[model samples]
Target: MSDIKIYSGSSQVRVMEIKNILENEGIEYQEVNKMDSSYAGIFGEIQLFVSEADAEKAIQLVETIKNK
Candidate 1:
């Protein structure tokens, strides 16, 4: 079986919010930082990851928040 899928968000706060939503829904996920040294002096993007199966649900949740 394949491991869960992962996504990359743009900011730490966004990643954390997504994580909390996933946790509340009892979904498992992994978060990884895609930052590199070239971005050290500048603002770096953060990533919010979830399993491929959960991708739709995660996106829906975020969309809901955005719509609100």
Candidate 2:
């Protein structure tokens, strides 16, 4: 179950939304902390990752959200 990123960004609201959706669907995911350490996430990217097996599914989920 190698980890792969399904989404990356600094949008807290958007990221949380997708995370909630993933959680509801029972998909396991990892959150990679890419935020700047000095400012504590002032200007950096956050990544949402899932297993390779769930990559496609995750992407689809994200796309569905995007379409909404």
Candidate 3:
């Protein structure tokens, strides 16, 4: 199954939190860093994805964290 994007953001702390949440839930995901290295914190975002099969649960978990 294809990977489905469930979250995207530029905050490292937030990103790490979500990653930890997913890991703790036993959800496998792929993280793509699109931040411009040369500019570091000046631009871009980090994206998180999971297989299509896991997308719904992943998105729900991420939303709960985001709403907190």
Candidate 4:
């Protein structure tokens, strides 16, 4: 299964929160440091990736957190 972007944000806290949600839900994922594209996050943000199958679920989890 191909990995796809599930979330992207500038806040490490936000990224970790989403990651925890995925972990709690048993949805596998990966953390991509968009910072590598710039000055090590000084000019970019963090990105979360999951398998294509988990992308939708991961997004839903993010939305749930957003609504809170």
What is the alpha-carbon lDDT for the whole of candidate 2?
Answer: 0.90
Top-TM-score structure, candidate number: 3
Error of 2 at 27 (Å): 0.2
After the best TM-score superposition of candidate 4, give how far the Cα of residue 27 lies from its true spot, in angstroms: 0.9
User: How far out, in Å, is residue 9 in model 2?
Assistant: 0.6
- The regions of model 3 sitting more than 4 angstroms off are none
Off by over 4 Å in 1: 1-7, 36-41
Query: What are the clashing pairs of model 3?
Result: none
Candidate 2 per-residue C-alpha lDDT over 1-68 given as tens digits, one digit per residue, 9 for 90 to 100: 68988998888788999999999999999998788878654789889999999899999999999899
Q: Give the TM-score (vs. native) of candidate 2.
A: 0.85
Off by over 4 Å in 2: 37-42
| Candidate 4 per-residue lDDT over residues 1-68, each given as its tens digit | 79998788777888889988899999999897876554554678888899998888888899999899
For every model shown, the clashing-pair count is 2, 0, 0, 1
Q: Which of the numbered candidates is closest to the native, going by highest lDDT? A: 3
Q: Order of candidates by lDDT, top first?
A: 3, 2, 4, 1
Estimated TM-score for each candidate = 0.64, 0.85, 0.93, 0.82
Off by over 4 Å in 4: 36-42
Computed on alpha carbons, the lDDT of every model, listed in order, comes to 0.68, 0.90, 0.92, 0.85
Candidate 3 lDDT, tens digit per residue, 1-68?
79999988889899899999999999999999999999866699999999999899999999899789
